[model samples]
Target chain A: MNKEWPLWEVFIRSRQGLDHKHAGSLHAADAAMAIENARDVYTRRMEGVSIWVVESKHIHASNPDDAGALYDPANDKAYRHPTFYDLPDELKHM
Target chain B: MKNQSLIDYTLHLADNALIIGHRNSEWCGHGPILEQDIAISNIALDLIGQARNLYQYAAELKGDHATEDSLAYLRDGWDFKNLLITELPNGDWAQTILRQFFFSTYQYFLYQQLQHSKDERLAAIAAKALKEVTYHLRWSSEWVIRLGDGTDESKQRMEKAVEELYAFTGEMFLPTDYEKELATNGISVGPESLKEKWTDKVRSVFEEATLASPFKENNSAWMQSGGKEGKHTEHLGFVLAEMQFLQRAYPGAEW
Candidate 1:
């Protein structure tokens, strides 16, 4: 009876969105309950058209200690920037 | 007024929502789990929202400067026409879940038929409220199954709740005079017509939950009634006193 339920990470796709963004996390006994908890927690105010829930333990995250090695090398590479390419004025969105 | 029956019928529907919403709100911060706390609170809000719509419609029909707030906050317990089941105390988590499941199942079928009412305004309100009621039925049904089929303590508590609550379920289908009058004019859905569908849904859910249907054992069990005619248990008086305190203390007050 003292045991804690598993945690789930909630993702919500807003009315105009194609991707589900991380909303928050909650505790539930199972995946079905997790989705419902997410609905009550995150989407009560018409915030989303869709919901996705993943068990917290199933999600893998990069270590914060690897930040410099993983990301700093690309920072000094100016050519990696798409801004380096010239675009025609006629191609407005690009 | 020419629409007295419709007005009373609308008020009955409003009272049912408000009283149940008030009961559910009592669990706002006291739920066993935080997630469930929010879930019950959301359901309470939805019921209150439905109450507001029905009250507004009733007020319009009643005229004479009546408003939704006045209709809801100023009415006495004896004037309320909600079924007895809605005003019963929330004994425990199991009782609250079972009461919600029973009431929501009835509402699901009732509103589905009401959406086709000859009265355009009533039909429109029913159509809008049906979406919220559908979710209520699902949430409460899931909880009923979870608790009924859970550990021994949970199962025992659910059984006790079923026993305590079954006697009140009959009153939902016992139409009051206003209901009977409005049903004939197609302005209201007859409660009698929704009984079979409600029973089917409840029996199916009970089978999954591993709980025996009380109706199966005693089809002719004596049911406590009279709430629709304004004869309510003492519980509703207490509920109204607390709910109406603010409005009574400070008339016309607004934030």
Candidate 2:
């Protein structure tokens, strides 16, 4: 019931080879309890093999005001893509 | 276990799940906390799923057009075959744990025995059910210890539940005459062999939790096998009423 404790986001990895995906959020007095809560809430249906809980306040984010500056250029950066590379003849032969 | 008489056996299994699961489902949104609520609901849903399987099989065995819905909802309470233990309400979290622990222990051993049953369909169903009952055992055992050794109030309540819940085990192990005949003919399994493992399971949990088993002294352990014979506790009637209320009201409707 302590108001000072922060919310935490829950991520679940459904299978051994899967990446952790956001499942839900919960409030807890501490990180350990947060992880435990996440497990109870999100994984009851065998929904995950792994669980991660990040204290909501501890997670930093790009501001909405800065999204255009941070992401617009990356969208059109063709040089950063793998398609720009020419295939070597020896590699192709193998 | 005859193809014709299998209806009785199947009804007993369905009634056990429906009754016990209904009692457990009452814990939804009312467990000690959110985690416990989720755990209880998880087990409740499993029991209901299990009951559905049994009911469907029973209907098929009876050659009735009745689906699991009609069998569960439309039937009178006398038609139910669950033991009195399952009909006992969830008096507390401890009661719930003790009830589940007792039932799951019996179920695990029973299903394991049934896995090798001569009846291929029963064997297959038991094999699939063994996994679910195994998890139910784990969940119930964890809480039995936690509650038994928890705060003073919790410890007292859990200990009391252990004592009060004793007599019910007799009926669980009381293989009926029909069941005996089936076991003799290799159609059904006996509950006697299942009793040893159930005792061991209960003993280990009680040992860790430091709770005493129900006192055997002056206790009426020998009781009639009512449920297997189609008799039930008074609670079953109300449970049927509530469980069947909607289905009965809206007959032929699909959820």
Report the number of the highest-lDDT candidate.
1
Q: For this target, which candidate reaches the highest DockQ against the unseen true structure? A: 1
Residue B208 in candidate 2, Cα distance off native in Å: 0.2
Candidate 1 similarity to native, TM-score: 0.96
TM-score of chain A of each: 0.90, 0.78
Q: Worst lDDT window (10 residues) for model 1 chain B?
A: B212-221
Query: Could you tell me which residue pairs clash in candidate 2?
Result: none
Model 2 C-alpha lDDT per residue in residues B1-255, reported as the tens digit of each score: 435456777788788888899989999999876666887888888889888988888887776487888888888877777888998878887888888998998999999988898878778888988988987887778778877877799899997887778777888888877677778767688888787788878888888998876535665566545877778777778888888888788887786
CAPRI-wise, candidate 1 is high
Poorest 10 consecutive residues by lDDT, candidate 2 chain B: B215-224
User: Please, what are the lDDT tens digits per residue for candidate 1 over residues A66-86?
Assistant: 999999999889887788777
Candidate 1 DockQ, CA atoms = 0.88
* Global Cα lDDT for candidate 2: 0.81
Best by TM-score: 1
DockQ of 2: 0.34
Residue A91's lDDT in candidate 2: 82
